[model samples]
Target: MSEAGPRLGGRRHSDERSSPQRSLGQRKPARTITIDGEHAGRRLDKFLRSQFKGVPAGLLFRLLRQGKLRVNGRKAQQNHRLQEGDVIDVPELHVDTAAAPRPAVPSTLLDQLRGAVLHEDDDLLIIDKPAGAAVHRGTDVSAGVIEALQHLRPELPELELSHRLDRGTSGVLALAKTPSMLRYLHGLLRDRKHEIERHYLAVVAGRWPADMDIVDAPLRREEDGVVVAGDGQSAETRVSVKRRIGNRATVVDVRLVTGRKHQIRVHLSHAGHPIAGDDRYGGRAFNRRVTGLGGPGIYLHAAKLVIPKPDGADLVVTAPMPRRWKALLNSDL
Candidate 1:
């Protein structure tokens, strides 16, 4: 097993010692213990509560659920029993540590960028995201827009991302300010009743007509670890060509009526005109054309989103094309 360090797409560690003035008050150092001959056969949670006094049972359970409490450096369930010679790793708990800090966003650029507000109430915030930024932590990155938002609003009781966005694609990003709101949003997503509307803009390899195009395909994980599957489950995507770019490419707008993993990219690729700069699904010749126009990020953007407001109204948000995309059009492609 690998030794744990700072998690990818997670917050940066503070070098300063824990202080009372900090948002999360002074924390007790984590304690690691090995079950020896005398100390054996104890329920993990039961033992932990006894060791750390004043910590709430609910909080302890949450830590365990989040995999913060581990046995032998591996995640252990709440009901797991510890035997002799087992090592328990306990994470430090700080007073007022409601949620982790969010990443910092530069104030200068915040005003310049047009981030359309999708839905905003006393308990929730949903923004229409652009393509360049990531939504969460993952293999290669740490700080994302969600983290940066957290840093901007540390006073929020419980800020959490309700859904995910691919690093290259973007759309409506929902944030819950309270646990109840988070649970509500989760239920909405699970029931497929998240009334949020999502749309995308892409430059595809070939010219498609203005007629409505629906691609119904199923997606599953491929052997290469990327998602790919035959038409096992129903996945639907609606595409309409907005304009023709050059001899080889056309600007298209896609509306995802039914959200699926890589639905647009997969469907468009399967249709033969993969999105420009999309190396994974795009043909080499199309990629070369986009590359010759600009550099190497996918030329797909989350164009628009519309969602019903909490107060019985509608909110429509849109993110304009990035400068690079405009530059690509200006160049001879």
Candidate 2:
């Protein structure tokens, strides 16, 4: 569970939009951030929103137009995709002084999270996130894995999601314990450098061939949350057949080359093998058939993560297959 190659390791919005950027002289001091590989290729506006969670979009646009926010000491456009190593100067804005308190996470959820921990250390916590559970609470979700864990371990106030897995998918999600560790890991993942490897196990609705192991495709996200293959963002996935059921399904191991939203699902479907139980994609028939036969939820699981540590060691983390997978795969296969 532990190895060493190298070990290392917001908010609020105000809606007042009256020339917020013009009052820079009276505003708080600015801060500079160095862009890394993880944030490379993202729009300038989007990156700022991530940094300043509660800032209004209008205010951000004003800042960009007024030349208050600069990249590499030069004025940048709102749609400017950032490059790694670029330095950005950010101007401060008024944030709501009184923020809403987080709601209490159910004790039952906390117990589930406690049992889901696969590995934990001073800098990182790896969890076997359950299927159908969101990693962080959103508008529709009241409490999620992140909220529950924070409540359960009140001492670790800095615990945060270093990456994310889809709600329908389950398995090895990592949480960083410190800011430096978070940045270190994010840089590795974003750049795809330092030998960071991620592997997934999936059950798809067809018999995939071992020879067809490479899926190099670009993905574009639609307004309705659907991903299509075309000229959007470049993405690739390496897929190999692990096991196959008689003329019905195949178990696949997927290595993501580019972490686009719904990348795996879109790529597999494009290859004519939609994941089982994925209704949003093309697995409705397969989902119905499996549900009628008492199958599990979506058949995608983040099984393993191998990350390079600062000390030139490898941090290998693994999660056991979900009970639903074991129960169904064993019986069905």
Candidate 3:
């Protein structure tokens, strides 16, 4: 919906409008899209789906196979990741032209996000991402934090996610307002430089030992859909007990020394103190218990980030602990 693209090389009458509710199976005029910073690294299918909302995935793949989708004037595949300045050609297909009919983002959430802005300059935007929201659309999520921001700020066409936080995790989500900033930040993260450090707050099951802080484990993804330690890529995390909540749980601060897939969740689980409400790592019983106490999903937050800038001053951003976590922390349980 929302007029997926600005018509290129086409003359339109002042009063004519394409049907608002056209079926995806019907034919329409072809259109071209020039990739920009926001869409640079997105997959072909995912990008197309975002543009032509309501189109089925299977049909999208079929269109790709039929050469209905082209990149830079050549046929492309669904998995093709778009690059900056690349041109995409989309064939005619029945598509909705109205704004997406999805539910509007809650005003409370929007207000929270608006108030959560930690830092913003010409190059970057940092927000305290709320829990239970994806950074971008994926699997079952149709619109995510970034999409919501795009809707709220239509003028920021170059806004791009610098890094990602899990859908269930909260706090300190960084976005790039320019491609160069995105690349620079990514480089710092990739090189594991001390210029940028990420810290998280996690509530875990059991009373964590005060001195048992480091978890160095190599992680590997197995064919069975599990990430196991001792036989994979190198990974490390620095853990410290922040608060002990009786014997039921402990609030801990985690420093991701080497980021990997589900690194914090898997390492903490392997260390025998899985983060509460982490369904994939923490058992279902633990999740039920935590939720039973009115805590939301996984109690992990990207609480703080420290970045060194060219002028020598550090850009430090911190997000307040969620109220539920605070309640749990101060509770007897």
Best by lDDT: 2
Model 2, poorest ten-residue lDDT window? Answer: 8-17
Residue-level lDDT tens digits of model 2 in 222-287: 887656656679888999988876678888999987788998988899899999888778666788
Of 1 and 2, the candidate ahead on TM-score is 2
Question: Candidate 1, residues 1-333: lDDT per residue as tens digits?
Answer: 123422212322111122233344567666666654323554677666644535767878888888897888998887787676687777777644344333345553244224446667766777766566777655565667665666556565346787677777655677776544565555655555655677788888877766648776777656552344664456778888787877777888888776767778888888778888987888897688688777777888777766555567766767767667876776656
- Which of 1 and 3 is the better model by lDDT? 3
Model 3 clash tally? 0
Using TM-score as the measure, name the better of candidate 1 and candidate 3: 3
- Scored by TM-score, the top model is 2
Report the C-alpha lDDT of model 3 over 115-150, residue by residue, as the tens digit: 778898877789999899888876687678887787
lDDT, residue 134, model 1: 74
Over 4 Å off in model 3, which ranges?
1-112, 223-226
TM-score of each: 0.64, 0.71, 0.70
Order the numbered candidates by TM-score, best leading: 2, 3, 1
**TM-score, cand. 3 vs. native:** 0.70
Q: Decide which is better by lDDT, 2 or 3.
A: 2
